[model samples]
Target: MAPTESNKRLALAIIDFLGSSLKDGTLTADDAESIEIAQSCIADTFKVDPTDEAAVKEAVGGQSLASIYSVYEKLRSKSTPQAGSASTEQSQTDKPKTGAPTAESDKFKSEGNALMSRKDYNGAIAQYTKALEIAPGNPIYLSNRAAAFSASSQHEKAAEDAELAVSVDSKYSKAWSRLGLARFDMGDYHAAKEAYEKGIEAEGNGGSDAMKRGLETSSRKIEEASRGTEPPSEELDSAPGASRGGGGMPDLSALAGMLGGGGGGGGMPDLGSMMSNPMFANMAQNLMGNPDMLNNLMGNPRLRQMAENFGQGGGMPDMSSLMSDPNIADMARNMMGGGAGGAGGAGQGGQGGQGQ
Candidate 1:
């Protein structure tokens, strides 16, 4: 599939940022080869040509590196595709045999969905791709693969599959939701919101709670994004329910209490405090539901030590590492996009989180 306009723009933004950094001496001459490699990867990801300098430059036009990277961080998901190819057969657990039967294809599809539920997105995408190989042009397969791609940080590819899915069957509400979600992750909130609206219409506007919740989240994002420019920090304090300066940000002190220290009642967070404290609440919720995410959170050195400290009955230790993680902060911002944030959609937050 050809790259979406959003994907092309992303590739261009990355190239332009690297080019500017090199020119400004912030990125050294020694980094040129690595920069070229990064550019090539972006090109492959978006189906653009690395050799076409003019096209690359035009797409970037004028966008900040910080902004581009923010979108990158935003779109990243739970799994990683190999650097330059999505069709690498070695990653696949079940490769489609030549002329595989329809039943065989369906079997692979079921396995893919199972992996997706388990948060094994890489395995899921591989299985989905294999299913597609057997049953080419299957819209349901396309939409399923798209969801897996989105889960695996393959937003551009996800968008490609989603677009294909919708074109194949206009009534496929799941595909519509997948498309909207992929676009949202790529920072195309307007398009995302529109797609969700379309999806609701496609679902007859009163179908599943999943679709309704999607519309609500997308609408919330549209509202948040319409703020134009931030008024100022002073103005933020006056905004409803926003606690500025004093402690608007998350209080890391709550994590120890939330994360399995007290057996039952004593450590449980009150709804009021939990609602007031987004960062801790988010972590707590994710930890409860996603074992993989819990592993990631605990894998951080500081968090590991925090666990040790908690076991020894220490008070709140330094959570600077968890607090300072750009990925975590971005996830928090995206989730609270409910407040000043709304980067949009549940799937927009961390999994294959970039360290940068």
Candidate 2:
């Protein structure tokens, strides 16, 4: 007797389960037996041999039962051909069509991140630029590019890119941080402080400690600059053998040496020797003589704190009281030909005390 429609559907379901198990390498002995029993109820349920590799390969041909069922269902939905009509055959096509460009953009973004991790800032910038070109207005891509720009020392461009990133997504803390640093380098301390503060506000209490510290430091510099002291200079002459006096130009190699050479020995200086050096003593005297000098040299908070600590030590003369002493001040001015001389020199007052 011919099989009923329900029986054929049952046979197909069993074939699908068996094929899936075989493809996934999870077919048990019981499942194999069930497939065999189900196949016996239908003449052409599945042609694949359960154990023979060549027969399975030839019969299955890498096609899942679902694909076969889909085609079968499509064929089943069509009307029967008329008698004596020309022969008709169905052709099945299963080619996967191309999708949208998101995959490519994602690929470029991943490559950019990898380059960034390796410190290849220029390569990272190029990759991120490509990603942005593919999907413009992506906040993450814009922010990543800004980081690369900042790493490359393109501070102005970095600031612009960071601004764009934050405009795209105001909650991007990293972009705000980059913008703050760039603005600070450009001498816009107030704007830098504001950017950092806004970032902290947006990020809540969990914001970065580094950003908070940076904001504080910049704010201090701004306050100090506004106190009617000397205007900022670009000199580098405070260090021995430096040419530009009192200008705050940084020497990278000298700083590196101060930080300890690449070999990483005990890189710190001998503070005891430095304290005992006459040159350092002269520097201290000079620093005290000109209060405005402190504004420039004290830009580094740690160094300023150290200088203040030194000033507070016992036996250090009170600068304000010394300045108020007319006899001492007049004698000091005369001794160095109208310049402020050392405590006791020829223009002559009695030697006050060792503390003086």
Query: What are the Cα lDDT values of the candidates?
Result: 0.64, 0.58
Residue-by-residue lDDT tens digits, candidate 2, 14-38: 5555657766778776677766666
- Estimate the Cα RMSD of every predicted model relative to the unseen true structure: 26.9, 25.8
Candidate 2 regions exceeding 4 Å error are: 1-101, 227-356
Model 1 stretches astray by more than 4 angstroms:
1-101, 230-356
Top candidate by lDDT = 1
lDDT of 1 by residue, 1-356 (tens): 88788778777767677777888898999999998888778877887764576676456432255544543443233123456765454546664433343887899999999999999999998898788666665778888989989988999999888876665556788998999899989988787777677677778947677777777787788778777566655534443221222334322333444443434334545555664686756654543433333334433444556666655767555557566856555544544334323332222333334231
Could you tell me every candidate's TM-score relative to the true structure? Answer: 0.37, 0.37
Per-candidate clashes come to 3, 2
Clashing pairs in model 2, backbone N/Cα/C closer than 3 A: 235-247, 237-244
